[model samples]
Target: MNRLDFLKHLGLLSAGAAILPTNFSSIKQSPFTELRGGIGMFSMQGGTIGWYTTDGAIVVIDSQFPDPAHAFVEGISAFGTGPQKVLFNSHHHGDHTGGNLVFENDGYTIIAQKNVPALQRTAAQNSDNEANQAYAATTFENEFSFDAGDETINAKYYGPAHTKGDSVIWFENANIAHMGDLVFNRLYPFIDRNGGAMISGWINLLETVAAKANSETLFIFGHGKPEFGVTGSREDLLHKRDFLSHLLEYTQKGIDAGRSREEITSRTSFDEFPEHISPSNFLSLPRNLDVAWLELTNS
Candidate 1:
């Protein structure tokens, strides 16, 4: 099966469903594969996780879920005796932060953008699953950076893209960036418009990120089509940017032509993005166009 189908089979396509308690015992442990300079990535379920192992500490980018998080902690112990562990949440999505409780209970320092806590709480409360979440103890407004042994880790917020609290975590020395859910790779992204996701801002943020990294820089994406994989370079970011741009342009044209909302959102594919097809009907072009219509009409 394709990677998107694999994700659907894992029951990860439904945002609300993912918040329900999962059968931890059924999950297989996912291993970390080093990318460069002690930095690596772990992928089992939910969003992809990025990790950094220093001489004295281990830094984690995003946590998938409690089960995977537990496996990650156990697996990383083989790295070194680094008692200082740091967790950075890329956003408030449950897929990324559901495992924060695992890290928090283990005495890890959890950090995230300032707006994450409120958004996280609201989401949990809405689902009546607040008991399962762990909020970040430390919060930053625009940018935050600190040293983890020889590596410098930077987290920065560039307005609202995927969500109001999305941040890009950069491991400076390793030249690796954990883009979180800001990038969906070749899949149709979950555009949380109600959660303050602005596609225009998202496109601009992608441009800023591409300009910040060089040709050699490596990026870990939250999700990817099996064919594309989860790790990529600057061009991948541009590809996503192009898709969002076209989405808006197409929706705008339909709106100007006095087409009905149903007609506009009924499209199944875009000639420019043939590879963007999603196996999950929830994330298909109709849903994306629905959100685009909402944004364009300011509804």
Candidate 2:
């Protein structure tokens, strides 16, 4: 078969294999009919972007890959009676910030962490640049809070995860926390080593958030559906810890056995959590494993 045909077949196979049985009765119904302080996950592959509506204005968190970003903003416009006041970028990744310029031109105040502007500036100067840098404005260093009608959304920068300048936004009154790319849910996290990301710091930060969350807190990950009133419980936190622990142990074992990187990648499989693995999982796994190995072994 041709390359396009092969990819199409692969997509169908993956979709069929990944189907999970759902209990319609047990499915938690959303509290609001209209989009409130929650996320509307587009396609399965699309990044999870959040929309917060308060008073008449709306605040969007992270724009999906470029084209979707425009569509997302347009969708929000239909629901919003008021204007779009702000478009908050969770990080500097293209998937998150691609729609920045578009939204900025449409009169949205694009807010992000301080490092984001610097990153965008660097990108603009780079030979491989494509992103519009004019979108970024109003960056915060440590923390900032804004009152939206009855709710207050607090933006804070933790150490780093996913990328160097990852920002986590917490809705104080709504009890909702939007963890940019910090918590990848079940998927293998993309740690931008070039962006000064450290696995240890990332894991540690997640632990801190887990401790802070309660039963009523709504946990919204960067790439997953929002969980209502179910923040990271002690048990859930332990599961995340265990996932990282296993990755570390397996990687070390491969290294001690004098296995090549390719061999290590092929051997290690997160089959228990198939959702975590990508198509081949080999390429990304080695890099991800290498990062975890370096962090654990060196520390």
At residue 221, candidate 1 shows an lDDT of: 92
lDDT accuracy of residue 95 in candidate 1: 84
The sequence of per-residue lDDT tens digits that candidate 1 reaches over residues 186-257 is 888889987899999999999999999999999999977767888999999999999999999999999999
> Which candidate wins on TM-score?
1
- TM-scores for candidates 1 onward, in order: 0.92, 0.75
Error of 2 at 1 (Å): 16
Clashing pairs in 2: none
lDDT of each: 0.87, 0.62
Q: Between which residue pairs do clashes occur in model 1?
A: none
Poorest stretch of ten by lDDT in candidate 2: 14-23
The superposed Cα distance between candidate 1 and the true structure at residue 286, in angstroms, equals 0.8
Candidate 2 colliding pairs, count: 0
